[model samples]
Target: MEVLQILHMNKGNDETSYAQNSKVQRKILSVVKPIIDEAVQKMLCSNIAPIGSMGIADLGCSSGPNTLLLISEIIDAIHATSSCSTSFTEFRVFLNDLFSNDFNTIFMSLPAFYNQLKEEKGAGFGSFFISAVPGSFYGRLFPAKSLHFVHSSSSLHWLSQVPPGLDCQAAGKALNKGKIYISKTSPQCVLEAYSLQFHKDFLLFLKSRAEEIVGGGRMVLSLIGRSSSDPSTQESCYQWELLAHALMSMVSEVNT
Candidate 1:
């Protein structure tokens, strides 16, 4: 098997299977961390509910080092909020990803993660009830009005799959043309379709969270974004093009 096929097989149908895309994923998280912190604090202070406790969920939480890094930031923020609030409140941290994801990896790693935090940062900081629940964040993943903060990074923009036929040739075309994703002149229809899917996915996210989060609950999302809303710009989608070629090459090799 080629390297990509091996990686895909390792994925095993998990949402977090996207872990293979680690470099870009980490880049996405780095850019969004500060924004999430601010949003969480605002939610805690807002007038929607008593600040006695908080529930924070990281949607599309993939397993690995990056997940741990994200949880650390969240724990710090929660502790800071708990310290300043007059009412004592506990904290719940939900790590959510697709059912196909390696939640087992997350669970197995948690004790170690917790131990490291306690040893490095001290135990008295913030009390966290950490749990990993398997589910797709593309749909509702929490109880209604149950969350105080929601955060996701690098995940929101990935389409469940690239548009169908995106890999297929025009019925009569040959592989000699040698391309799979964007060409110099992909029709506007394809771009618009992808954009529409993003919009729909984003709306579902908002709607689900609207009810799951209390009135003052805050959401912070950071994903790979376009330089602008223009759909036709190559700058906005160069990575998708590269990934397609990579996948296509893998498929070709596997069949041969």
Candidate 2:
């Protein structure tokens, strides 16, 4: 299956929806809030031409409370640092995610989000214009030099697709059989394929963003990672290991 067609989090307010199960992601966002604030402040205070209108892009902005929470944090940082001389009067906010993301859920929540912004920031707090841009961030999704600040959290570990030759059909056999990701038992070839895919995807991401972000723009990206260099380390692939085990167990039960 194509990853983009099926890679979204469970949608709506169901028990298994990403909206209900994203506490860890929220914690990660909170932990990185200070870094986001610092980056926004520096972007604003830099000695560049005065910005009357600012462009901010939140890449991989999944649906839920955290989506608007991130926007609110950024706005708060801007409000705190804005002086009469350096105040921005207009904001162009872009929320980006994959084509299959639960964007409708986010859209349904916008009325309350706008109301809260109005109540807290007041009538004179400037204009916020938000739009969603749907696509992969591994490639270009915005016009050249159109963005000033970019933020992404709890995303970017996703490759554009599964690593090449790891598939059963491509390899003519099940390479890394019974596993969904790199594992201690995965052969050297499986590890190399994943690493190569990551490098290729990441480099494309940087090149795409380079065309979209202005000269002095700032980006804050927080992603899942580990300190260990080994790709098969438990710290790096344990979650997938457990998931694979569960899936294999289900398969065995079905066959039995």
lDDT of 1 by residue, 103-198 (tens): 676677789888987886577665778998676676788888778778888777665555555445665753224444344456665566566767
What TM-score would each prediction reach against the true structure? 0.79, 0.94
lDDT of 2 by residue, 1-256 (tens): 7897678988888889999989999999999999998998888888545456789999989898789999999999988877632657899999999999999999999999999999998978889999999999999999988889999998898898999778765447688889999998999999999999999999999999999988888999999888998989988889999999999999999999
On a 0 to 100 scale, what is the lDDT of residue 11 in model 2?
A: 88
Question: Candidate 2: RMSD over Cα atoms?
Answer: 1.8
Q: What Cα-based lDDT does every candidate model obtain? A: 0.68, 0.89
> Which regions of candidate 1 fall more than 4 Å away from where they truly are?
1-21, 86-88, 161-183
Cα deviation of 171 in candidate 2 (Å)?
A: 9.1
lDDT for 2 (candidate 1): 26
Best-fitting candidate, scored by lDDT: 2
